[model samples]
Target: MFIESFLILLALNFLSAGGVNRPEERIVGGGPIEIEQAPWQVSFQIRGHHICGGSIYNADTIITAAHCFFLSGAWQDPRHYEIRAGSKSIKSNGILVKVAAVKVHEYYVHKENQFFVLQNDIAVVRLSERLQFTNKVQPIPLAESNPEPGTMSFATGWGNMYGADAGDANKIPIHLQGVKLRIQSPNFCVRFHGQSKICAGDSKHTICTHDSGGPLVINRQLVGVTSGRGPNCDRPATFSSVPYHREWILNAVKSFPQHV
Candidate 1:
């Protein structure tokens, strides 16, 4: 019972703070990520502050972590949301895309010991407009296959620094901070209470704070969504595995009304 037993305990211990998934790993060398002509990433505003990470899949849709605002009994309306596409600078990104709809997993439990850790953690946000691909902003290629262990990748966000002085202060990247880490599995990571659906950080350097909802990039293809920091971003990155949620993403795309 991965979700029922192991996941339950982890949710109780870590998710008690009310955010996305977490863990640690070794970072690929190069200090911080060097800016290249890469695809556009997305960020969301929660409670007047940006705490969520996401990526543009199409002109009208963005993918993010479901836990962004999914707390039992107190979740806020997902309307009035925003997404920044082109630029890497969190404060000065190019396009500020407005959201038209927010779709979360219907079976999401937000509970302990659930069998579906990969199900409810994924979400889709429909944008009110379509985007023209640009040098600094473009859609990342979707996952073509599940990442095998030891596959190296990058995760980016403006969520928070592992040691944030004040909440949301360490968030919102002054500059895009990207770290390289390899993917591990629940085989041994779950011993420390991780899920099988996530790629464990190599326990080297932590993923940066502002990286939630950001993309777990591998070989230039989008692999995972930065769901949560593993109590420390300097460790390995924990993610909501995109490979395991392909059908869910397709359904969300299909279920979206096109009237807008």
Candidate 2:
């Protein structure tokens, strides 16, 4: 009885220490992701502080979770965000691009439930200038079709391994991280929001704080965008389904101004 009580207390402490469904979460049981392993991975920041991970979809366009811009309040100004590409380390060298515009999904909504529920949690960021692709930088193609449930996928981010506190310096990792996770059934995550979200991984291969806005790729194609995740990072990580909103993304990218 005493041991069970201690365990319950420990769980409660963890929840209190790391808030649930943080804005930007990371891989909990993943290893270091090398600089060139995922060239399309980009660090989304505000004033040089890494807040979330994003993907380079084209020479001038990025895709991330809408919650990154819409959570806590209404959408924020694009000028307040910066995109850093070609860097494995958030603090290392990379091409910093000023945001030209922000395009969030029209139906996105945040709910204040026991779960940090997000619906249609997807967005795009247009760069002020075209990024020069190098050995360390490139664009990833979006999945034309959704990966079937149970398919294995890969996710990358710069979030913490220990928990969600950016102030906890010791838990923060400098190098980017990646984890292999299996895609869970849309029905499995339906309770959180609906079929628009994909739940992947479990408690071990979970997304923790600072990894939000990252991409879930299968066979080099982005199939999902990291959105809300559980307090423990181990709860099946929820992501915005990319395939479901592919049309919107393409239209948004096409409508945005392109720099020559």
Candidate 3:
């Protein structure tokens, strides 16, 4: 079992008036990436600043970590900022939308219940306006169709350079932090039986930190949102399991609720 701690907030990039600031594009394992993928990759902003990477699904919603919302002492209400999806650079203009509302899993308990991100650390944000789909800015597929296990997956976010905490105070270009992890034994899932969750990353490499609330994508579909460390962030191996609360995810996304 892994230990739990405070759900910390780390900033990657903040949205600027021009758009977001991003870095160069890199692919994981030399796999092919769609040229239009930039359109769907998103960056979360608090009060129009403090960037956290995300991805768009439908015309009206984005999926990211609830911890970004949970740990922040800032952010009071959903406001109009920018949802830059297509641009490689966070500063580049892509799809800009206002944050209409947020619908985080109701049972999501951060600091207290560390092992399990109760209600699953998933969150949905409704945009102020519908986003225009472009070659680079379209929604990635969802895992609800059949969240793949033990498949090639990709993750992207702007957290840190290394040896750091989760939430930083800067936003670089929307970069891809790609690594290859497999869905290990559901029975092998540690700490309160991460049976409902999928374990990724090798025990010696490619773990998570500020990448929480990011995407655990497989076959171009979103299977899980970056939850947090099972025990600690530096454990070399971390788990980003899908929540068993499918009803909450599906039901809310089906109707599209509001969160801030």
TM-scores for the candidates? 0.77, 0.88, 0.70
lDDT of 3 by residue, 20-98 (tens): 1111111222222333543556766544443455668788888876655643323434553346666555444665576
After superposition, the stretches of candidate 2 with alpha carbons farther than 4 Å from their true spots are 1-24, 190-194
Point out where model 3 deviates above 4 Å. Answer: 1-39, 72-75, 80-82, 112-119, 145-150, 166-174, 186-190, 207-209, 230-243, 257-260
Give residue 78's error in model 2 in angstroms.
Answer: 1.4
Higher-lDDT candidate among 2 and 3? 2
Instruction: Please list all clashing residue pairs in model 2, or write none if there are none.
Output: 24-209, 24-210, 25-208, 25-209, 25-210, 25-211, 25-212, 26-208, 202-234, 203-234
Candidate 2, after superposition: displacement of residue 105 in Å?
Answer: 0.4
lDDT of 2 by residue, 169-247 (tens): 5666788999998988766643554557778887788777778889999998998999877666657788888888899
The best candidate in terms of lDDT: 2
Over the stretch 78-186, how does candidate 1's per-residue lDDT look in tens digits?
Answer: 5545776676565665777677888887765454342113334678888888877777667776785778887777776654444422233433345556666767764
lDDT of the candidates, in the order given: 0.58, 0.78, 0.51
